[model samples]
Target: FDQNPLAQMVVVGIKAGIGERNSNLSGNPQDVLKSISDRHKLEPTGEPSLQNSIKMVRDSME
Candidate 1:
C-alpha cells in the first residue's frame, strides 16, 4: 500500500476452515485495513485447509 502507489490489495479471511473473500481488490489502504479488522473479529472454528483456502483465493482472483 501506502508505500506502493501502483499496488492494489485484496483481503481474504479463512472462514469455516476455508478462504473466504472479504474484500474486493482495492488500492486504498483504508479499505484493506478495515477488511482485515472486520475479518479478525470472527471466532475461528474447524481445522484449517490450506489447499482449499488457496483454491478459493485463486478462484476469486481468476
Candidate 2:
C-alpha cells in the first residue's frame, strides 16, 4: 500500500463543501475544518450541516 493517504485526505477535504460564511471559522479555517471533518469520520465537509454544526460546537469543548 504505497498510497498517499495525507494527500487524499486534503483532496477529500477541499471537496467537502466549504463556503464564504464558513471561510472564517478560524484564521486558518480551511485547515481547521479539515481536522474537524476528519475527527467525525467525515470527508471534511465545511458546510457544517445541522448535524455537523452541533457536533462542531460540542467538539469545541474538548
Candidate 3:
C-alpha cells in the first residue's frame, strides 16, 4: 500500500469519509469532497464531477 499511489488514495478517501462522519464541521458535501480530492492529489477529469466522485467513494464504504 505504501508503494502504490492508488492504494494510498483509497485509504485516504476512506479516512476522509470516516473523519467527516466523526467531525462536528458542517458545510456542503462538495467542499468536503474537494478537500479530500486535493489531499489525495485528485482532479476532476470531465467524466465525473467531484461531487459524483465523492458520492461514489462514500457509497463504496457502505
Pick the TM-score winner.
1
Residue-level lDDT of model 1, residues 1-62, one tens digit each, is 69988998887666567777788899899998998898788888877777887898788767
Per-prediction TM-score to the true structure, in the order listed: 0.81, 0.24, 0.28
- Tell me, by lDDT, which candidate is best: 1
Alpha carbon lDDT of each predicted model: 0.82, 0.41, 0.44
Q: What is the lDDT of candidate 2?
A: 0.41
The total number of steric clashes, by the backbone 3 Å criterion, in model 1 comes to 0
Clashing pairs in 2: none
- Order by lDDT, highest first: 1, 3, 2
Candidate 1, residue 3: the lDDT equals 91
Which lDDT tens digits does candidate 2 get at residues 24-47? 233444575666665567345435
Candidate 1 residue pairs that clash: none
Residue 1 displacement (Å), model 1: 2.5
C-alpha lDDT (0 to 100) for residue 35 of candidate 1: 89
Report RMSD (Å) for each prediction in the order shown. Answer: 1.4, 12.7, 14.0
Q: In candidate 3, residue 25 scores what lDDT?
A: 32
Off by over 4 Å in 3: 1-48
Pairs of colliding residues, candidate 3: none
